[model samples]
Target: MKKAITKRLATIILAFMILTLCLNYVLQVHNARNDMYLDAKNKFWQINQILKQNEKETEQVKEDLKANCLIRAKAAAYILQYRPEITEDQEEMEKIARLLQVDEFHLFDKEGTLYAGSEPKYFGLNFTSGEQMQFFLPMLKDRELELCQDITPNTAEQKLMQYAAVWREDGEGIVQIGLEPDRVLESMKKNELSYIFSLVTADSGTTIYAIDPGTYQILGCTDGELAGKSITDVGVDPGTKMNQGFSARVNGEDSYCVFTDGDSVILGITESNRGLYKDVNSNCLLTAVYLVLISIIMIVSISKYMDYYVVRGISSVNQRLEKITKGNLDTKVEVETTPEFKELSGRINLMVDSLLDTTNKLTKILEAARVPIGVYEYNKDMKRVMATGRVADILMLTEEEARELLLDHVLFEKKLEDIRLHPVTGGKDVYRLPGEREHFIRMNTFSNANSILGIIIDVTEDMVEKQHIEKERDIDLLTGLYSRRAFYRKMEELFKAPEELGHAVILMADADNLKKVNDDYGHENGDRYLQGIAVILRSCKAEKQVLARISGDEFVVFLYQCRDREVLSAHIRELLLTMKGSTVELSNSKEIPVRFSVGCAYYPEDGRDYRELLSLSDHNMYQSKRNRER
Candidate 1:
């Protein structure tokens, strides 16, 4: 492990060092070539300045020759008009040309034909004979026009010469003179770029060129082989770019090239890359040696530190983890050599301790929850019910049976089927086994996605309390009989079996002396008298009898399943005789006989509306009370 870590770290260090070296090498090479490129560009600019100056000097010399040529032509024209004898005298014109230091002279008549000149060669040449002589044609009509032309070949001999012409002073004819242009030729020779190229100095492998801007023609070159050739033939393209440097093969050798434009020339230079970066490569080689030595020292130092700190600390951590994974959770990680490792160790310990704490809390909670409350979850895919231990106890299963049920969902459902749905007190349903004294379990089930989750709670106490509350709601507290609402509900249920309602009677009885008893002997005696009437109503009951103390002093009896209406009336008469026998002993130990005003309404004979039958019975009860009072 230590070797792997160290090897990986060393690989990273070497990669970074190599990357740095490559970047440094590239930067140095760029700077070296840039220095040479800038120098060549500067030199091109110097060559342009020299070419411009030469152009200005050449222009001044050409202007001097133009004036000299015009002055000589005017002198010869003055002579031709004054000395008319020389009009056709070749010898005299020749002598006149010699006197003016000119090369030739000519005379044209008004017809615009050349009649004579110093070098006539028989002399019948017209002004239209050559392009050079056409300039004086316009002078024939305007004698005031004087013209001097640039140096060119004459029409007769095609010898290079400068010519100027004017009409004879008297308009007799035109006189023209020609000169050799010796001074202008001499000035241009000195201004030639070839002469300048010879004077340029540069390092070895560098070349200088002067090219014609219009033709891309190489006018001059320091390497003489390129002279007088098109720039393209020498692998140089004199493009529109100026005063910029670029890299290319020039003369089939890799070179740095720069170009600039002069007045009438393209000044350019090329330098070899070999000499450009020589010192840069040698310096980089030395730097690489030093970097290698430094890298070796750094690797050794880092490896030693790894052996002591990182490797040892991680080994201890791994050992503790191995023990914990094997169930020795008491093992603690305590490596503290470095802050990073120390934090890692503390986190591992805390995580293990948290695992144990969570397990303990869950155990205690499961133990506490299983007795009174249990959970059973089932999904179709699961083979067994996931349940609490209390579920088995609630189902009255032994340990072995519970285990079988937990392992097999089919067995669990079969066990559930064996439990009976029994009717408990107060009309609520509870679940138990088919045996006496079995604990009641309330089933609250939630179902979704073909799965049922039943929360089983031992609600024995809750059911008992609920029954007590229901009894209070449905029973009269004073007389322990059904209240008015319960009595009516039972009557409605009884009427659902209409065949049994044929002989049924609804009897309403009022204690005739209850008000008097309450007034003379306080309300305690009134309550006892009413309770005695409830007893009498309960005494003579038929198979389907319902008794209720409905109000302060009224008791109701529903006697059904009798032989006929007459038998129902006989049942009521027996109830009245019981009421007469029934009496209450008051708080004062005074005895009061329970006398009741009894009235009956027969069902169906009184038309089956409970309120109507109850109304008729109450009316009959008041009539009986009136009769007793009389």
Candidate 2:
């Protein structure tokens, strides 16, 4: 009997040892996974923080550029108004140039002939042939007071920067202020790595400037070499390297690379995955070994006692749990054993009862939740509608209709694709539904490799409000005409449209002596004079045209299908003559004569499109005014 008992006891001890080892391994694996997940979360948070900081710095830089440009534009306007003769006066030009803090200030005649600048040699040099000149022509034609151009000068010595505002004084020719590119970059530098800086053409991704001042690395080709090269044309190898993980070692150490394609910027950070994994493995191994040792000692010491008091009791409790798991929650464990076993069985039965009650309550709550909730299985070939709750009532669809809508295989498949294609975060559209309102159907997609979850929210009021806000922004509040920004938007749209059979005409008009009228009469009178000219321009338009008050006293009209320049010029001249005849009665009942200068340029004939036409017309208008003064 003693020998038989020993063999049975040995078998029990071996079983306990195996169970303890398995439990230790499971616990170690669970802890290791949790640690890795936490690490990843922390790393992602760090990246997000960096991105936010960079964005703030970039915004500050943009604000500074705007402020600087405003100051320069105002200065240029002052010089143009007070110093027309100063265009030829080198001393005056130098004084104003110093005050403006620019390398050079150039005055272009209405014909785009360089009339005067700090550099006397450039005078009379025509810029009719260059693409850069063509771009600025439209702004001048429109008499855009706050226009800015990012252009490289024809002179090789001057680097590229923004030229803000092409101003034309009543008696003076058009004046342009050149701002330094380095100054713009310097304004944006919040910290060492604040700028994701590159200089590219407005419409193309050609890297004219790509330097990291922090690293002193000419990311573009050597200075003056890659001045006009596209980002793709630069000879950086596109091959995938081994250390190209989320965080990788470059040049034998871990570092992040900020890449800019002159337009878009990307930042990549790498970490030592090998070192991370090694540390994790070591920790897990140590933890497992320690736990296993402790478990083995406990199992050996308590095997007989546990078998008598705990294991058999646990088995009985598990059998009762199995009944609960099988949907027999009414079945409870019998308490006919030792006090410890009895207590455990009682607790397990009580826990099961509580869980059942909670589950029953939850089911009732979900059933009462009237908003329709659904789950669907989506695959490449088909979309199978799986489950839905009562939220379909808001859809105004009957249960049957709702079911039919949900089950429509073709519709479901298309909707699923739409959802997959349109994300809800980061400039993505969202649809939402409010109480008993318009049925807002917003489609957005959520996805992983194998599955996707698309959520729809009905956004009825939001869409309406957004539309209203946009309309308000596009319309000018002062004169009830199209704002300058709106004009630019329309121009962009027109330029993007398919080429028509005939040419388009853009006419730029400026109110003559409006500032002098304001100074002599009052601002209210000045406003009336501007409104008067706007009325005349609006009256002259018969075709589908955009009449916009771009600035203080400047207006632009887009004329479509107009071929006769003489007819347009005659009409403009007639309007100007009428304006010269018309007078604004001020608060003191003093009549002030209203006069305006008009310039016209045709598409493809004068220049290609809006920019070129505007430039040509502006140049011509200035020339006309200059001759009139002479």
Candidate 3:
């Protein structure tokens, strides 16, 4: 009996020692993982700050380039306007072009005739003739103003140049200068800003890549092999998960990648997380070894002093602890042999019951949550663990089916693939359920070494509401056309760059007798007249044509990509003929025919912006109205 008591006491001592060592090891691991997360977060924050500063500097450089170009053009125009003799002499014009360091130089007469230029081939060209006429004629019509054109090919110079021309203060002619884009860009010296990338030091395992957002091409990188490759080619998605940083595998190693967008480019910094936990893990392993040696010493010393009187009860309690560790929390220690052992057994059982209750409550709360929450760990085999809730409903599966789908990784492979490429937080993606009901789900994700935790919320209603608001905000309620504000917005979108706009025309039209119609037939009748005109305009509009009622009596139509001016005139003529034949009868049975005065301006010939085109067309419309009055 004494020998049995000794053996049981030895077993209990060994088990306690092992449990103490294991708990210590687990605490060390948790601390190490936390430090790693902190290190990664700090690195990302630092890198993103540097990227934002570089972007701001780049934007400032762009603004300075434009400002400096304008200054140079104004100075050149001021000099040339005072000296008309240079326009008459080709030698003088060539000398002036060289002196100003301009790619091309020209002078126009008050009639917009190219009186003299460095290129003799273009000397007789009229500013009001052909496709290029609109750009220069607007200065004449607007009464002697300065103007600048975007980059375009100057066949005379055989290079791309940006043209800036100004009217002579004396109104004699216009002084025009052309700048080589390359020269202007060189003068700005944006390339010097590349040194900013070098300031971010990346160790052996880390990398920093500068990318051109416009082209998604790598401009500079710590790795020479990554240079000239697109962001995608280097395993980075330029279009995916912008602004927010993410974690993914790069070059077969886990890395944290942070992205910062500049005015013209994107900066990506990739950092490896291996070194962050290295020291902590090493120390934990050493400490665990030390604890094992100490535990062995304690086991040997305690066995000799333990007596047979307490052995049976302690063994029974130890057995229950072993069962609890193996997930048998309901098992209680049967320790009624001694009064002391009975109290100890009751306390142990109480602690285990409390732990079990807490765990069950937490599980129920997660199950009741409206948002879908999940964890995915990918190591050897991909495993997904999801909280019980709307996750199954969202996936259009029963709870059991959802678990099966996750285990198979079939239904969610695409989503998982994207997440593997780039882990997203508050990122938007659309998914179709089993019933084909599409939903917009937003995910806020947290990532560790090889695992991701996500909270998904359905935002379909929010998205629909925003779109409806935008539609209402941009449309004119009364005329069923775009509002004045929307007209300008659409024009900005359609005519983003000057080169993209080919043969565009703006037509400004006004009701000729709107005031007379209103006074004679009352305000309600005038509204009917206006609605009738809107119907006609809507009927005449083709694809991509934007028509808007900008004022009470004024309407504007932007005819996009209509190369032939005759086509525009024919359309207007047909509309007039239709209006001439049709009449609106008011409540008094009084019939009135609609008449309109229209003036048109061509793009890249008249002006580039809406203000410039509208001013010219409006002037012409008033002039036409005056002619009709005569």
Instruction: Name the top lDDT candidate.
Output: 1
Candidate 1, 445: how far from true, in Å? 5.8
Per TM-score, the best of the predicted structures is 1
Q: RMSDs, each prediction?
A: 49.6, 21.8, 21.8
Model 1 residue 500 lDDT score: 61
- For 331-403, candidate 3 gives per-residue lDDT tens digits of 7886876788888888988887795564455556766774354333222134334333455554455767766
* lDDT: the better of candidates 2 and 3: 3
Residue-wise C-alpha lDDT for candidate 2, range 405-432, written one tens digit per residue:
5554566555345435534343346543
Order by lDDT, highest first = 1, 3, 2
Query: In model 3, where do residues sit more than 4 Å from their true spots?
Result: 1-382, 395-401, 408-413, 416-438, 449-451, 520-522, 585-591
Off by over 4 Å in 1: 1-363, 369-371, 377-385, 420-434, 444-454
User: What lDDT tens digits, residue by residue, belong to model 1 across residues 497-593?
Assistant: 7876667778888778677888899997788887777677777867778889888878888777777888887787787677667778899898878
Which pairs clash in model 3?
134-605, 134-606, 135-605
User: What's the C-alpha lDDT at position 43 in model 3?
Assistant: 50
Model 2 weakest lDDT span, ten residues long: 199-208
Q: How far does residue 224 in candidate 3 sit from its true spot (Å)?
A: 97
Look at candidate 1 and tell me the lDDT of residue 423.
44
TM-score of 1: 0.40
Show where candidate 2 strays beyond 4 Å: 1-71, 83-89, 129-131, 137-147, 156-158, 183-274, 288-630
